[model samples]
Each structure stands twice: as C-alpha cells, then as structure tokens.
Target: MKKIRNFCIIAHIDHGKSTLADRLLEFTKTVSQREMQAQLLDNMDLERERGITIKSHAIQMNYVYKGEEYILNLIDTPGHVDFSYEVSRSIAACEGALLLVDASQGTEAQTISNLYLAINHDLVIIPVLNKIDLPGAMPEEIKDEMVDLLGCDRGDIIPASGKEGIGIEDILNAIVERIPAPVGNPDGPLQALIFDSVFNSYRGIEVIFRVKNGSIRKGDKVKFMATGKEYIADEIGTLGLQQIPKQVVECGDVGYLISGIKVAKEVKVGDTFTHIDRPASEAIVGFSEVKPMVFAGIYPVDTSEFEELREAMEKLQLNDAALVWEPETSAALGFGFRCGFLGMLHMEIVQERLEREFDMTVITTVPSVQFRVLTTKEKLLNISAPSEMPEPNFIKYIEEPYINAQIITKSDYIGPILNLCMDKRGILKNQIYLTAERVELQFLIPLAEVVFDFFDKLKTISRGYASLDYELAGYQESDMVKLDVMLNGEAVDALSAIVHRSKSYEWGKKLCEKLRELIPRQMFEIAIQAAIGQKIIARETVKAMRKDVLAKCYGGDISRKRKLLEKQKKGKKRMRQVGSVEIPQEAFMAVLKIN
Candidate 1:
C-alpha cells in the first residue's frame, strides 16, 4: 500500500495530456519500443484522428524509482467539455492529478474547469508545464499563473516537454513522492466503485473499478449496490497494455472484473460493488448518473434496418452510459430512436461511431435540448423532439434549458465576440480580466442557441483565438415558438425548429432560402414556406421544370403550337394542384447546417 500511487492526467484538448501519458508508458516500459504507438492511451480510432481523448483509460504500471519498486496506476481522461462527467468520475477514482498545461497556449477554458473539478474531488494536483519545446513557449508566465491558481510553491511546478521526452523522470518521481497512497482498510468488508464498464459478447460485462476496501477474488460473489444483482466473479485482472489475469485485487488497486452478466444494461457506471456475503451497510455516495442535455432523433436510412439500429445503439450504450434512447416514430422519417447526449460533439461522435463501427447508414434530425412544456390543464411534460411537442393551443408556456457560458479570449476581439453572443440571445452575467491581454466574459444563454453554430461563429469572430466552457444553469422561460417548414403547403416536422419570437422571422427566412437551394425542382412548382402556427413568416418558390412541349412540332402550324402550349400549361397547373413534393435527405441535413 505504501508503494502504490494513483493519479490521473487532466488538461484541455490538444494540450499534450495524451502525449505525456505515452511518455510515461514508455518510461515505465509498460509497452516495449516495438509495441508502442502514438497516443497509446487513446485506443479509439476517432480519438487518434481527431487528436482528442474521447474515453477514460486506466493502466497499471511497474516503475522503479531510486532502487525502489513503485506500483503506479495512471488514468488518462478526455479533455473535451462534453466529457466533463467522465473527467469527474476519473478524478474520484484517483488520489492526485497531473494538471498539464500547454506552455505555448498557457491555460484554456477546459483547463480551468477541470482544475476546479479536481479541487472539488480533493485530489492533490501536481502542476506540469508541457510543450516547452515549442517556439512560443512561455514557461515563467505559466508557472506564475499556476502558482496563483493552485497556491503551490513555484519549485513544485515541473517544467517538461512531453513530445521531446524531457523531465519524464522528474514527473515519475513527483508522482511517487508527492501523491499520497490510497488510504482504506484491507481488513474491512469489500467495497469497490465501478468507474467504467464495457460489454464483451463472449465474456459478458467487464467492469473497471477501484477497490476501496477489502479485496476481490475470482470466486467472490459480487453484488451491485444500485442494481442489487449478484454474480460470481468469473475472472479478475489488472490492465497493463492488455488485460492480465490476477488471483486477487486488494484495496487501493484498480482492476477489471468479469461478472458473467450478458447484457450491457445490467452494469452501470458509478455503481458500487460489494461482496454478497459481507455487503456494506450502505452504497457509496457521490455517484450521480449522467443526464443527457441534448436530444436528437436518429433513424436508419432504410426502415427495414430499424432492428439493426436498435442493436447498434444497445451495444453503444454498453460503453456510453451518458447516452439515453428509446423507440420513437416520426410521421416524416418513419421509425427511429430519439437519443439524448451530453453535447453536440458527443452526439456527433455517437452518430459517427454507429455509421463507421456498426456499418449502418443513419439519418439524424436537428439536435434539440429537452424542453419543459406546461399544458392547458397544468400537466407538465418533457419534450425531447419537436414532433413530441404538443400543439401550441394545448400548452401554456414552455421552458428551455439554459447554460452558464464562459468565453476566454484576447481583449481586442471582445467587441465582435460580445456582439455574436448577443445575437445568440446571451444575457451578460459577469466579466473578468484574467490578465491585461486576456478577458473572460460570462453569459447565461439558451442551450439551444449554442447547440447550433454559435461555437463556430465565436471562433470566426475571434479568429480561432477564443475558448469556451459551459455548464447547465437550469431552465428559463422565453418567448419561444416552434417554427415549421411547409413544402407544398404541408408541414415537415423534421424541419421544424424552436426559435425566439424576436428572431423567428430571420430564422424562418434563412431556413426557407437554404431549403430552396437544397431541394431539387420537380415537375410542378414547389412552394417552400416557414410558418409559426398558422402565420407564414417567410416563403420561397421553386419554379417548376419546363419541357419543350412545342419542340416536337417542327414547322408546325401556329394552331398546333398554341394547342400544345395550352395543354402543357394546363398539365403543369393540375400537377401543381395534386402533386406532393418528395424532400430529399440532403435537404433535411442542409437545414441543420443553416445558420
């Protein structure tokens, strides 16, 4: 127990957290030179391609420091704001964290947010300045900021370049020396916290957990406190670069347990595991289930593949507990699953994974935040999709989720960025100057406003110099209405959007214009109109396709040409009266990209 060190790496995206993990793995020789890969901890292909960590990974290492063998358990965490919950869970499982900051970029929005989370978890933070090899490195300034933020001595801050393998030894020593060993009773009843879990078709549910008290063995009967399900531990092991079976995993040790549960839904993140014979009196506290904030309906391109989509989502939910979904039907898109996610990026990653990993073609509706609707009879309901919303007459007022957003950028671009926020209906909360050159602006904005193109617009205005972080601030009342798009005088519910009354006209007009460009022309004229209830706010006309009906009559009489023209005109008018427009899938997707 004295030789065990548990810690994790936390930083903003692209801040060398993954790289430092790789260096640590290399230094400890967890993987030989021939077996090592870049971003070793980021096992997902999407993570490697995007240069971001999407999942939290834990690996145990054997390190020798000053002729003493040390047992090091390192957990690498995602740096994106969407996975902040994952970060919190990872911190809860560790005793300390390596707060890695990019020496060139200094601290970012996510850096501050993650630091606060670690502080809340009561984890000892060891500040490390990374990427010192970059030409624009500012080590002294960053050290000063760390001292101010952490109130730690300047000598405690380790300066290293993760990419260049500088100061790797110093970091390893700091972890063993500064970070305290896990404190728990080995003689007490068994209690372990499930930080994460994954489903295996052959082995069933494999759970990764940190043993808090006593020990677990292969034959131990483990009970999940939340689910009250007991299963004989078929296997127990620790994670190196791969799973290595172990006879026993004692207190303060991180390891995997195969519980013989076949379904993914049986195991959940943040659940407590205890020995069935000597179960703890109470489950561990501070284990909160992840609640998804963003909602979108995902439908298979082929209706027949609905079952495959369902299976895919079930398998996905095994690893992603933050994801929530249920069967739903759409009048426009047929059967699909209305899924909830943490944020837009998380939603995108799941969609991409389904398409790429599951080999299924899917169509996703425009993302929406859950809305609280009050009916005329005072019935409260939660609306996850626009199609789920009741008619305007059936409801009283609707409340939309809002977020407390923080934007950090240079002072010169403050004007444009603030104007952009205002356009997104942002209400100013507070502003602070982090330094003479950098300003942090805080706002309370509707989650719907930021879910679309607000982040891209902020980047555009700030020339890619700004960073953003936000947290849910609960629901707020607004003059919001559902703006529906009508094609050939029929409402397309999939194209419907919720907009503020003040900007409904602009959004409707813009949506109409974008749809007109995306939707192909048909045999008959197509009228594309945007409506708020019965009132049409904007409209665009897609002219009918013209055919040379008279071209077939070469050198014909004037009467013949006139008759042909009249007949063609009459046919077009009839077609316009009875023909229903077929909206292409591209048009549905195009509306989502409309800003």
Candidate 2:
C-alpha cells in the first residue's frame, strides 16, 4: 500500500486536464504509442466530436523510482460545470488532485468550485500551470493567482505545457514524492465504495469500485450495504488497457467487479460493498445522493415504444448515475418519463445519446425547474412539471429554486452581464476584482432563468470570455403562475410552463407567435391561444387553406352566389369541430427558441 498512489486531475473546461492526462500516460508508458490518441480517456464519440470530457475514466499505471516499482491509479475527470457530479465521485476515490490551470486564462469560476471540492475532501493539492507554450501564456501571472487561491509557496507550482510535453517527468515525480499512498487494513473486514458502473449486453453490469479496508478475491460473496442484496463475484479485475483479471484485488486498489447481475438499478453508485461473511460496521462517509436541478419530459415519437425507451433509460442511467427519472404520462405526449438532470447540458446529452445509441427517435418538452407549492390545507408539495401544479384556488403560494451563480470575466463586460442577470429578475449578491483586468461577479438568480439560454447569451455578450458556475441556493417565495397553451380550446399539457407573474404574459405571447410560424395549415382554421387559468394572455390563428366555392358560380346571379357561400360556411364550421391538429415535432422544440 505504501507504493500505491491514487490521484485525479481537476480543471475548468477547455483547460489541459485531458491533455495533461495524455502526457502522463505517455511518459509512464501505460498506453502504447500506437494506441495513443488525443483525449485518450474520453471514449465517447460525442465527447471526441465536441472536444469535451463527459465521463470520468480510471486506469492503472506503473512507475519505477529509485530502483523501486510503484503502482499509480489515476482517474481523469471532466471539466464542465454540468458534469461536476462526475468530478465529485472521482475525488471521493482519490487521495490527491492535480489542480491544472490555464496559464493564459488563469483561474475561472469552475476552477474555484472544483478547488473547493478537493479542499473539502482533504486531498493533497498540486498546482500545475499548463499551456506555457502558447503565445498568450502568462505563467508568472497565473502562478501568482494560484498562490493566492491555494495559499501555497511559489516553488510548489509547476510550469508546463501539455501540448509541448514539457514538465511531464516533473509531474510524475511530484506524484511519487508528494501524494501519499492509500492506507487501510488489508487483513480487516471487507469494505469498498462503488463509484461508477457500466452495462454490457453480453456480460452484464460492470461495477468499478475502490477497496479501502479488506481484500476481495474472485468468487467471493459480496453484499451491498445500500440495497442489502448479495451476489457472487463472477469476475474481479483491475482497470488497465483492458480488464486485467487478478487473483485478488488488495486494499487501497481500484478495480472492476462483475457479478452477473442483469438489472441496472440493483447496483447503485456510491453504495458500499462488503463480504457477506464479514461485513463492515457502516457505509462509507462523505457520499450522498445527487440532486438534479433541471427537470424535463422525454417521450418517444412512437408511443408504442414506451417500454423500449424505459429500458434504454435504465441502461443509460447505469452509466450516468446523476440522471434520475420516473415514469410519467402527458395528455399532449402520451407515456413518457420525467427526467431530472444536473443541468441543460446534461439533459441535452442524454437526449442525443438516446437517439444515437438506442436508435429511438424522441421528442422532449420544455425544460423546467422544480418548485415548492403550499396549499390552502397546509400541504407542501414538490412540483417538477406544470401539469403537477394545483389549481389556483387550492394553492397558497409557490416557491421557485434559486442558485448562487458566479461569473469570472474581464472587467469591461461587467455592465452587460449585470444587465442580463437583472433582466432575469436576479439580485446581485456581491462582486470582487480578482485582478486589475479580471473580475468575479456573484448573483442570486432563479434556476428557471438559467435553464433556458442564459449561458449562451452570457457567452455572446462577453465574447466567449466569461465562465459560469452555479449551485442551488434553496427556494424563495415568488409571484409565479402556470402558463398553458391551448390548440383550438383544448389545453396541451406538454407546452405548459410555470413562469414568474411579471413575465408570464410576454413569454406566452412569444410562444404563441413562434408556434404560429411552425404549425402547418390545416383544412380548418386553428386557434392557438395561451391562457392563464380562465384568461387568455395571447392568441394566434393559422388560417385554413381555402378553396373558392364562389369560383365555380362566377357567372351565376347574386342570389345563387350567396347560396353557395352559405353552404361552404356551414361545412367549414362542422369540419373545425371534428378536425384535430397534428402538431409537428418542430413545434414542440420551437418553444425553446422563443426569445
């Protein structure tokens, strides 16, 4: 155990976390040159295409120092704010973290947030300045920033360039010298924490965990503390270039276990595993269930494929444990699932994977944040969708979720950012000038406001220089109302939204106009109305494709023309009553583009 070092890499998006990870792997020769590629740990094609890390990957490496061989377990974590849960899980399984900062961009919002997470875990922090080879690189300036943020000595920060392979050996040496090895009683009771899992069609669910207190061998009877279920360890191995089968994975080692369990929900991430013969005293500490901030409905285009969609979600959930969902049905969109995601990006990724991976065409409704509702009878309820809202007479008050949002950018863009937040009904909490040119602004904004297009707008106004990081700050009572869209008098529940009273009318008006442009014309006129309770807030009409009944009787007398027009009018009124509008898929997605 003295020779085993467990650590992970932490940084902001577009930073050198994945790039540095590649250099470390290359220097250690854990992966051959022929198999090496950019962002080697990022295995998903979507990740490669977007140049972002969506999942945390773990691998084992060997290094020899001073004529002694040492085993190193490195976990590469994602840098995006939406995937912070992945970073938290990775931090839980490590003893140290390499805080990589961009020498040119300095420390951003996500960098500060991820640093706090590592500090809370009491992990050893090794600061490294990456991209020193770039023309805009400012190693000295970033080193000073790191010193201020981490409170470490000047010499403690390593200056390197991931693209140029500089300081790779220095980083490896720091890991062997600074980071402490895992400490546990190998002969004690079996205790392990499952951090992640993946599903395989042929083998079953593969659970990846780190052993802390005892040894686990092949064919051992393991028991999960959370589920209180027992299963035989069909196969156990360490994660390397492949699943390297071992006779026994000792304490303080990370490895994968296959139990032949087919069900995905049976094995929960963050659950502890122990031997049935000798169980641990309690579960692992500092691990809690993830709370999703954004909720949306995902339904298949074909209603009959509901069962298949459910199965696809289950398998996807096994890989992304942060995703939480429950079966739900909608009047506008038949049977579907109400999925809770960490953020909009996480929701988007899930929807794309469902279509690309499972080959299931799906339609997603408007995204919303969970609200707290109190009724006249003093009953408190959690409403995730507008359909779950209680009637106006039965409700006492509604409280929406808010977040503590932090934006780090240049001082010149502060005015526009403040205006954007204010327009969203946000309150400026605090502001500080980190440097002469860089400023950090904090605001308390409703989660619903940021769920739409706040991030994109901020990026645009700031010229892509601003970075945002946020956390749920709790709930606050607000003037909120439910906005519903009706097609020809019948309410479409899927298009409903719970918005602030001040903006409900404008939001409804915009949605109606957007829908008018997307909904195709039918045989009869269609009335698209946006209403709040009994009052219509906004309305638009799609005129029917008219045929000239008077064209055939142009040469007839005035009385004959009047008679043909009367007959056509009666037929049109009857058709309007029986005809139903078939809303295209684009109309459902168009609600998001409404400014």
Candidate 3:
C-alpha cells in the first residue's frame, strides 16, 4: 500500500495541464512513442478540436526509483470552471494534486478556485510553473506570486515546461516524496468508491472506482450501496492505454468493474461498492453535491422521440453526474426535460454530446437562473422556469440567486471590467492588487445577469486577458418580473425570462427586435411583442410576403387597378386570419443573441 501514490492534475484552462500530463506519461514509459499523441488523456474528439479537456481521465503509470517499483495512479482533470465538478470528484479520489500555473499568465481565477477545492479536501499541493519555453515566460514573478498564495518556500516551487520536457524528473520525485500513500487495510471488509462510469452498447455499464478498503476480485459478488443491487463482477481491470484485466484489485488501487449491468440508471457515480457477503459497515462519504447555476429545457426535435431522449439523458447522466434533470412539458415546445447545468458552456456541451453520441436531435430553450418567489398566501416556491412563476397579483416578492464574482486582469482594463459588472447589476465588494500589473476585483452580482453574455463580453473587453471565477452567494430580494415574448399576440412560454424590473423594458425591446429578425416571414404579418403581464413594453412587426397583385394589369385603367388592389387586400386580410406563423428554430436561439 505504501508503494502506491494517487494524484491528479488541476489548473486553469489552457495552462498546459494536459501537455504536462502527456510528458509525465512519456517519461514514465506508460505510453510508448508510437502510440503517444498530443493530449493523450483527452481522447474525446470534441475535447481535441476545442483544445480543452472536458472529462477527467484516469490512467496508471509504473516507475522504478531507488531500485524499487512504485505504482502511480494519475487522473487528468478539466480546467474550465464549468467542469469544476469533475475536478472536485477527481480531487476527492486522490491524495495529492499538481497545481500547474502558466508562467506568463501567472495564476488566474480558476487556478485559485481549483487550488481552494484541493486544499479543502486536504490534498498535498505541489506547485509547478508550466510553459517556461514561451518567450514571455516570467518564472521569477510567478514564483513570487506562488509564494504569496501558497505560503511555501521559494525552493519548493518547481519551474517546468511541458512543451520542452523540463522538470519531469523533479515532478516525479516530488510526487513520490511529498504526496502520501493511500491508507487502508486489506483485511477490512470491502469498501470502494465509484468516481465515474461509462456506458457500452455491447457489454454493459463500466464503473471506474478506487478501492478504499479490502479488495475486489473477478467473479466476486458486488453490491452497489445506493441502489442495493447485486451483480457478479464479470471483469476487473486497471486503466491504462487500454483496460488491462486483472484477477484481483486490492486496496489503494483504482480500477474498472464490469458486471453485465445493462441498465445505465442502475449504476450511479459516487456510489459505494462492497462485497455482498461481507460488506463494509457503511458506504464511503462522497464529494459535495453539484449545484447547477443555469436551467434550460432540452426537447427532441420530433415529439414522438421523447422516450428515446429520456433514455439518452439517462445514459448521459451516468457519464456526467453533475447534470440534473426532471421531466417537464411546455405549452409551445411539448414534452421535454428541464436540465440544470453548471453554466452555459456545460449546457452547450451536453446538447452537442446528445447529438454526437446519442444521435438525438434536440432543441434547447432559453437558459434561465433559479428564482425564489413568495406569494400573498404566505407560500414560498422555487421557480426554475418563468412559466412556473405565479401571477403578478399573487406574488409578494421575488429573490434572485446572486454570486460572488472574482475577476483577475491587468490594471489597464480595471475601469472597463468594473463598468461591465456594474451594468449587469453587480455591486463592487472588494478589490486588491496582487501586483502593480495585476489586479483582482470582487463583485456581488445576480447569477441571472451572467447567464447570457457577461463572460463573452468580459473576454472581448479585456482582449482575452481577464479570467473570472464565481460562486453562489445565496439569494437576495430584488424587484424581478417575468418578461414574456408573444408571437402574433400569443404568449410562447419557452421564450419567457425573469428579469429585474429596472432592466425589463430595455431587455424586452432588444428581444422583440431580435425575434423580428429571426422569425421567418409568412403569408401574414407576425407581431412580435415583449410584455410584462398585460402591459406591452416593446413590439416589432415582421411584414407578410406579398405577391404583386397589379403586375398582371398591363396598360389597364386606374379603376381596374384599384379594383384588383382592393380584392388582393381583402384576400390578404382573410389569409392573415387563417394562416399561422411557423417559428423557426433560430427564433428560439435569438434570445441568447439579444444584446
């Protein structure tokens, strides 16, 4: 047990975490040269194309030091804030973390946040400065920053470049020397924690777990603690370039278990597995529960495929435990599931995965943040969608979710960043200068404000230098109203949004104009109106497509032309009464595009 070291890599996005991971694998000879490639851990195509890691990948490495062989279990994690839940789960399973910081960029918001997560789990943190090969690398300055942040000695910080393969030996030595080994008794009853799982069409659900106590062997009777279901362990294996099956996986090791469990819903991430005959006293306590920041509806393009969509979602949940969903029906969009996502990016990835992996074509509604409502009857309700909001007359007050946002950027952009935050109803909470060149500004802003275009705008204004990390700060009373969009005077529940009363007028105007451009023109005029209850604040008209009625009247009398025009006008009026507008898919997406 003392020979096994479990660790993971944590960093901000684009900070060479994956690149460093690749170098580690190469140095340990875990992956051969012919089989190795860039971002080897990020096997997903979407991850490679976007130049980011979306999932946490686990692999084992064997290394010999001081004439002794040591087992190293490495889990590579995503860097984006949206995938922080993945980082947290990986951190929970490991005993130490490699905190990689970009030398040129220094430590950003996500770096600080992820470091805090690792610290909370009481994991040993090894600070490593990456990208030293870059021309703009500032090893000395970043080292000082690390000293201030981590309060560790200057000599302890390791400067390395993943691209140039520098400090690989130092990092390996640090992991073995600094990080502690897993502590468990092989004689104890079986106790294993399932960190992640994936579905297979041919075999069944493959569960990836770390043995906390005792051991698991092939053909052992395993019971999932949460589900209370029993199954025979068909195969047990450790993860490598490929899953290498083993007859036994003892304590302090991570491996995969396949048991002919075909149902995706049966396997739960973070659940505990024990021997059915000699089970552990209790299940292992898992990581913190996932808190979703954004809520959106996902519906199949074809209504009849609702069941198929549900099954797809079930399988996806097995892969992504952070995704929370419940069945719901919309008056306009029909039946669908209301999904809670970590952020907009998380929602986009889920939608894309549904299409690419499950072959499910889906339409996602406008995203909204959760709201708290109190009615005159003294009943409180939690509202995720605007359609669930009570009538204006019955509501007493509304509270919106707020977040504590931290922005790290160069001093030159502080003015613009502050202005953007203030425009989003953000209140400045604190500001501190980590250095003369870098500043960190803190704000308290409503979560709903950032759900749309705040991040994109911040990136644009800062010229891609600003990094943001935020956490829910709880709820506060706000003058909030439900803004509804109506097409041809009929309310479309899918387009409704909960906005602050002060900004509702401006938001309504922008939404109406956006819908006017996105909704296709039909035989009849489509009046796009944005209203709060019965009061219409903004309206736009999409004119009907008209055919020239007088084109056939060549060299005709004025009376003839007049009669033809009058007949055509009457026919158009009748068509307007009978014709219905077809809301294009882009119209639903226009809500996100509205500035």
The ten-residue window of minimal lDDT in model 2 covers 548-557
Candidate 3 backbone collisions, by pair: none
CA lDDT of 61 in candidate 3? Answer: 98
For candidate 1, the clash count comes to: 0
Predictions ranked by lDDT, top down?
Answer: 3, 2, 1
Per-residue C-alpha lDDT of model 1 across residues 1-595, encoded as one tens digit per residue: 7888999999988899889999999999898999898999888889989988888999999999889999999999999888888898899899999999999887889899999999988899999999999999989988887888789999999999889999999999999999999998999999899998877778887899999889998899989998888899889999999899999998999999987787667787888999988998887664566878788889999999999999889888877777899999988889999999988889889999998889999998988888999999999998888877788999899999899999988899999988988888899899898878878899999998998778778889899889999988999878889999999888988889887899899989998999899888999899999998899999999999999887678795799999988998999999988988877778777766876
Q: How much does candidate 3 score in TM-score?
A: 0.98
What's the lDDT for candidate 1? 0.89
Q: Which ranges of candidate 2 are over 4 A from the true structure?
A: none
The lDDT of each candidate is: 0.89, 0.93, 0.94
Off by over 4 Å in 1: 555-557, 573-580
Pairwise lDDT winner, candidates 1 and 2: 2
Error of 2 at 265 (Å): 1.0
Q: What are the RMSD figures for all models against the true structure?
A: 1.7, 1.0, 1.2
